[model samples]
Target: MTILFDQCNENLAAGNAIKLFADYKVDVLIGPTTNIPALPVFILATYYNVPLITWGMTSSAVLDDSPRFPTAGILSVGSKRYTIYVQ
Candidate 1:
């Protein structure tokens, strides 16, 4: 397996994600590593049919939706866990 990294400003994540998919042609994608950036990247990954693995500070509950993000797997605690804790 091969891993490639791209460092993108949060605002540039979606566009950079396209480059990773269309240009680099990555099979599996890992991280925007934070919630805001990860949101758009998750949508794009679904469109491209690529599996996504998120880590670090990416704790959005939305990322855990299997129907919405069938190809995604989170390596950290999603916000849903926090919701359960709070309740």
Candidate 2:
């Protein structure tokens, strides 16, 4: 398995990173750490029909497999996804 890394810099450069990954015909994406940046990756993954596994972010929406991101799942350690965020 090959690993690839991109510096999204707070979702600002996520689109470019996704494009780069697609151009390389990558099979899957590992993470973006935060949901803000991973959001675009989620959509792009669906556009390219690639699977995206995001870590650290607590977004329950990724588990829904919606049309925007059908093959996406969140790998979060926090429980806010199932509960309320106090902060």
Best by lDDT: 1
TM-score of each: 0.83, 0.64
- lDDT of every predicted structure (CA atoms): 0.84, 0.63
12-75: candidate 1 lDDT, tens digit per residue:
8888788888988998888878888888888999999999998998898888798999998899
Candidate 2 weakest ten by summed lDDT: 57-66
Q: Over the full model, what C-alpha lDDT does candidate 1 score relative to the true structure?
A: 0.84
Q: List the residue pairs that clash in candidate 1.
A: none
lDDT of 2 by residue, 1-87 (tens): 555454545455465556656677777777766656776766777777777777765354444445657777777754544555545
In candidate 1, where is summed lDDT lowest over 10 consecutive residues?
Answer: 1-10
